[model samples]
Target: MMNILKRVITVLLCLILIAVAVVYFYMKQPQFGALPEGVRLERIKKSPHYRDGKFRNLEEKPTIAEGYSLVGELWESLTKDYPRTAPKDSLPSVKTNLKTIPADRNVIVWFGHSSFFLQLDGVKILVDPVFSGKASPLPWGVKAYKGSDIYTAEDMPEIDYMLLSHDHYDHLDYETVKALQPKVKYVICGLGAGSHYQKWGYTGRQIIEKDWGDKQEVKPGFTIYTESTHHDGGRGFTSSQALWLSFFIQSPSMNIYYSGDGGYSTRFKKISEKYPSIDWAIMECGQYNKAWQSVHELPEEVAQATTELKAKNMLPVHHSKFTLAKHSWDEPLERISALSQSKNYRLATPMIGEVIRLDDPAQTFKQWWKAVK
Candidate 1:
């Protein structure tokens, strides 16, 4: 009987080892990406925000909100009511020909989630472009909504600059980067994020990684200032090896602020105090829950942040493509729209691939998601 018990224990150990091996193999795939190393590591360590081998936010933040148990939240997310997490029908979208967009026109087109195409002063900039149709390391994980992926690399024109906010799978897709490599001129991202681009075949000359508070004049009339965000970054099991950031883009014709994935913080007010006036604020307004409130902002908080930033107009993003949270997919738009109305904040709600004329600050879009069901 003792021999039989030992045999059972041996079999269980073998099974556990096999499972661990499988997981390790899967994580080593190119999609998981390489972390900052060697020279990149040295550069990251120089930042004042770097501490104890990881970058830190302005203040200490918990990944999960106060009083929330990580295990309990995960269980609830796995087995809770998540109605309308996806649209019932294909979402409505316009297929704009990027190459044909006039060089003189300043326009912005969103491709759902955090990806956006910006054309100003004949310079084409693509931000957090994930046109690969999925937002996860595995193909089945975090698939995009139907009709949301109307734009692809093939549809893109020669890009002047590609702005990557962080190294998260949703923001920095491996396949998308490879597909756009031939047409891309420069890759701009937060500190240590260029390691993944280097691993994926981009040379040092093609990438520019900046720490928080770093400013660069990319061109004669265009300047970029990196600012802090209340978030963390990593492509693999580790976290915060690189910085997460928002960008204040100053151009001759416009001033735009992009709040990469972040929770509500005093940083918004700081940005307003520094910039004085932002012509357009592309803000994150979705994929939020109390469980992860410290990382992502609630819809009301988005409105408050917009007000704090002194932005002339707000374009809500980080929704309508993938359902990362349990709330109804359209809930963000509904809530932000109502809040903007009550607070008298100007809001821009363009459909996927619909061109937004930057000069027309008063331009409005139809409630496109209302017809999705």
Candidate 2:
């Protein structure tokens, strides 16, 4: 009996070791990316927010909401009754020829989720571009909704600047970055985020990493300021080693604000007080749940943030692409649309690949999602 028990224990230990070895090698792939090292780490260490070996938010807050266990929430999300998390059919889109669009016209195109294209003052900018279809390091993770991936790197023209808000896989896709590297003249991102680009074979000169409160003039007429956001960043098991950010873009003719991703806080109100004339505010309005309110904003909070920013027009994003939350895919759009109408806020709801003239606040889009089953 003693000899039989010893054999069973030895086999169990061997199986656990084999599993660990397999996971280690799998994570070593380029998709997992490298952490900030050498100069990148030196720069990250200098930021005031960096302390105790990690970046800190403006205020102390829990990543998961109070009284919620991450394990339990994830179990519920995987097994509970989730309704309309994805569209019943392929979503409608208009494949506009980006290269043929007139250079003088300032316009913005939504490619769904946090990715978008902006042409301001004749300079082309792409933000948080994740055209790889999947939003995770693993191929089977979070995938883009059907028909939401109409635009690809092949469709893009020469990009003047590429803006990366954070290091999260959804916001900073590895495959998409490699594809766009040739056309991208300069890459702007939060502190330490350029490490992923460096690991992916981009020259150090082509990347510009900045801390919050830093400003840079990217072109003769375009300037970008790094702003605070109440969020964390990581691609693997680690978290908050690098900075996450929002952006305040100032051009000769317009000022645009991009809220990368964050929960409700006084920071938005402070930003509005500083820059009272934001022409268009691109706000994150999806993938929110009570379990993770510390990072992502609820739909109602998005509307309130728009009002706080004093933006002339609001373009809701971070939805209609991947099902990162338990809420219905259309909930973000439906709720924000209703709130905008009641509050008399100007809203822009362009379809995927459809363009909206940035200067024209009254430009309207069809309620396309309402017809989708």
Candidate 3:
């Protein structure tokens, strides 16, 4: 009995050591250029991890219990208990000819999820682009819906700037980034995310890392500032070891906010206070459940959160592209539109690849999902 117990302990220690070594190797910071002049490392005052009026060093969270069940249930439905009815209509298709933007004001096009293709003052920018067929660490893990080929990285026009929110597999695809690296002039990322890109061989013009509220003017008319999000950032093991953020783009003609996957918080009100009457807010509206309340905002909360931002117009994303949640795929749109109608918020109906003229924020999105399912 004594020999067996000692062997078990040895095996456990070996397993622990192996995990530590792998994490250290994968999570090492990359050699990159100096962060921009205004950028600095800092912590949020009122974050959940704060205590005694000081920021607590975030401990490594082994796993998130809250969202674990949601992911498990979603997996079961996809594998074992899929609906008897056929899957909904595949995502909308974009025209073959990728639309060109005139050297003029700002135009935003949704590539599904939080990814958006923007041309402001003739500078092309792609935000949170993930062109891979899946949003998982492995290509075979979680597949995206079929038939929604609005644009691929190969189809993309020369991208002047690539803005990333974090290093999650979904947002920062290794294959997509490697393919587009040559054409991309500049890459911007939240603090610590540059480490991931560095591992993936992003040596040329390393990403511009910024803390929340840190602003950088990419050019004359296009400026990007990091904003707050109630979410943790890290690909695996460590929690908040890296920074997660939203981008606030200020152009000559428009000011827009991209809420990259976050739970509801007073930060929206703070952002609204900072930039009142934001022209358009690209917000998350899907892949949410109450189990993960602190990580993602539900459809109803999305409406309330937008009201807090005081946005003039809003576009719903993070849905219709990937099946990341167990809820009926189209449920987010159905619920959010109802909530938006109740709140009287101006919502834009932007099909994948459809150009949303920033100046004319009056278009209503068709109930595309209703017909889809």
Q: State the weakest 10-residue window (summed lDDT) of model 3.
A: 31-40
Candidate 3 total steric clashes: 1
Q: Each candidate: what lDDT?
A: 0.91, 0.90, 0.71
**Which 10-residue span in candidate 2 carries the lowest summed lDDT?**
341-350
Error of 2 at 45 (Å): 1.0
Instruction: Score residue 354 of candidate 3 by CA lDDT.
Output: 76
Lowest-lDDT window of 10 residues in candidate 1? 337-346
Candidate 1 structure quality by residue, lDDT tens digits, 59-121: 897888789899998898888887888888998999999999989999999999999999988
What TM-score does each of the candidates earn? 0.98, 0.98, 0.79
- After TM-score superposition, what is the CA distance of residue 15 in candidate 2 from its true location, in Å? 1.4
Q: Tens digit of lDDT per residue, candidate 2, span 1-373?
A: 9999999999999999999998899989998778898978988888899998898998988889988998999899778999999998899998999999898999999999999999999899999999999998876788898999988998998999899888999899888999999999999888878888999988988899889898889678789999999988998888887689999999999999999999989998999988888999999999999889889999889999999898888899999999999999999999999889866468988889999999886677888999987
